[model samples]
Target: MVEIKRPSPTDLLTIGEVVARTGVAASALHFYERKGLIHPERTAGGTRLYPRHVERRIAIIQVAKRLGIPLSEVAEQFGTLPSDRMPSLRDWNRLNERWRARLRARQLELERLQEEMTQCIGCGCVSLNACLVMNPGDQLGAEGHGARRLLPIEDEVPEGVGRDSH
Candidate 1:
């Protein structure tokens, strides 16, 4: 079980509070609110007041976006919870479960990326001078979308395997 650091104990959280609770920058919280994923109320003096749930939601949104989940997908998940109102423990638990699953996938991806990069960092370093990357026809980003392949390829298909069964 993960424990969120309660940076603010009061009902109202300041911009800095949001930053600490969400591990997001204060500017990002403002941007997300402007994007309508988070709605913070105003005080009599016009200070922004966010329910504690917004902190958790912002954390979830940050992770989801880092994984390249679209804003619509994050919105759909936010719709499952009561935004204007504080969430019950059950609601928080449900959010935690979803987050843990996403984190697990992200963890696996990072492990594989580490392996790929470690392979690329070999002492021989001859691959750097190889013509393998000199071909104008070859492109790595063209092979896949999203950040999953931001690292180098660890494997490529065998030659002659593209022949159709006859």
Candidate 2:
């Protein structure tokens, strides 16, 4: 009879075990280590061993990637977490709040883009020079050239500018 060994909660996991459990590629794990996103201990033979909490960290990293957040930003956020121990629920909640704001802003920008595209399609006049609704008397050119409306708005819209002006 073959006996299957079950890992205890306190036991450090091998790289193979982590890959199997997290469904992340071994290459990706190595890349994360290289990027300073995760820190694992090395055995006398140089085998990597990850703490149980690393699974949670990898999950956070994967979610950030899916949301289009840069790895640099992930590293910035991770910097706030405690390195000596697993992150607490409160720590995770703080990160969630920050990411939620960014995601909300992105969602609003996408919605704005969708509305502008719908207006452009409805007019059937793709000519920017003749489009009075989008550009009138080349006013946007005064703000510096190249798709002025497509640029991300950082502050209050200027008077006689933007979709609201149309």
Candidate 3:
């Protein structure tokens, strides 16, 4: 039988190697490529060859995803970097700083929703007092549609329900 050759750890890694190393699906890597999140080089025969640093990038992408950052957003952030190199610690710090505010805001919004959900649990239907106070002639519907009251606006947070609400 002919000997099967494998890429050395110091050499460029193929997509399959990246999948094995990173535990990210091959399809996701392709999607990352398409979205411009990752930039892999092509061999003369057209096989994708990723620098070893891609493993770290893939890990970063996974962490960002778990933090509820969208792939588009990840792509946008990663787009600021040089394609062939690993992101530096400073780069990671900058990325985190940029995402910190957005993540905090999202956390606040979710907390607000949770509070609203808890408060509104008792009244399941149109009641005399709750209806007048909550729906208020369906004014929320005018804003668009779909449980508008459930998602309260920043200014609309009830007397005791926002930052001060909690």
Candidate 4:
């Protein structure tokens, strides 16, 4: 895998540069700004000016989105990030740790789902007798009668359900 290098402190990045570095679209970055997850300043010419830290934040935001985390949750997970300054090491570390845990949980939940799917495929739905899909841990289907559920989960779970652990 290729290593991602952080830009030097002296290097200020444009929104385009940040986009290129993070592999996130400019529109997505704008969406993050609207959600208060990331922000870039307006230049005198009205272009967006971003710091190197913003690139890092964009990367984090993208991964969180891929894990099905809504922008609302991401904002809650990370307190307001200031647009006028560089993010501190402590802030980055705390955010990184939190997101990593969320991603890990998401991976585990997905693994659980995949295993149940494999069981279903192999045992001809007989394992649905014990699987989370057919028989969740609790009276999950009691709330409503439907083909599917409003909430995908059959039981109450903490945030970031499916995560991959190394």
Structural similarity to truth (TM-score) of each candidate? 0.47, 0.74, 0.67, 0.58
Instruction: Find the candidate with the highest lDDT and give its number.
Output: 2
TM-score of 4: 0.58
**lDDT scores for all predictions?**
0.70, 0.86, 0.78, 0.72
Model 3, 1-166: lDDT tens per residue? 9999874434688898899988999999999888888778898899999888777778888998899888888888888766767677898889889899898999998897776566676556454334434554665566664664455576666675556534
After superposition, which runs of candidate 4 have C-alpha atoms over 4 Å from their true positions?
1-12, 80-83, 111-132, 137-166
lDDT of 2 by residue, 94-123 (tens): 999999999999999889777777787897
- Cα lDDT, model 1, residue 28: 78
Q: Decide which is better by lDDT, 2 or 4.
A: 2
Worst 10 residues of 3 by lDDT: 125-134
Ranking by lDDT: 2, 3, 4, 1
Best by TM-score: 2
Estimate the Cα RMSD of every predicted model relative to the unseen true structure: 14.3, 12.0, 13.8, 15.8
Clashes of each: 0, 0, 3, 12
Instruction: Please report, as a residue range, the 10-residue window in candidate 4 with the lowest summed lDDT.
Output: 140-149
How far out, in Å, is residue 162 in model 3?
A: 53
Clashing pairs in 2: none
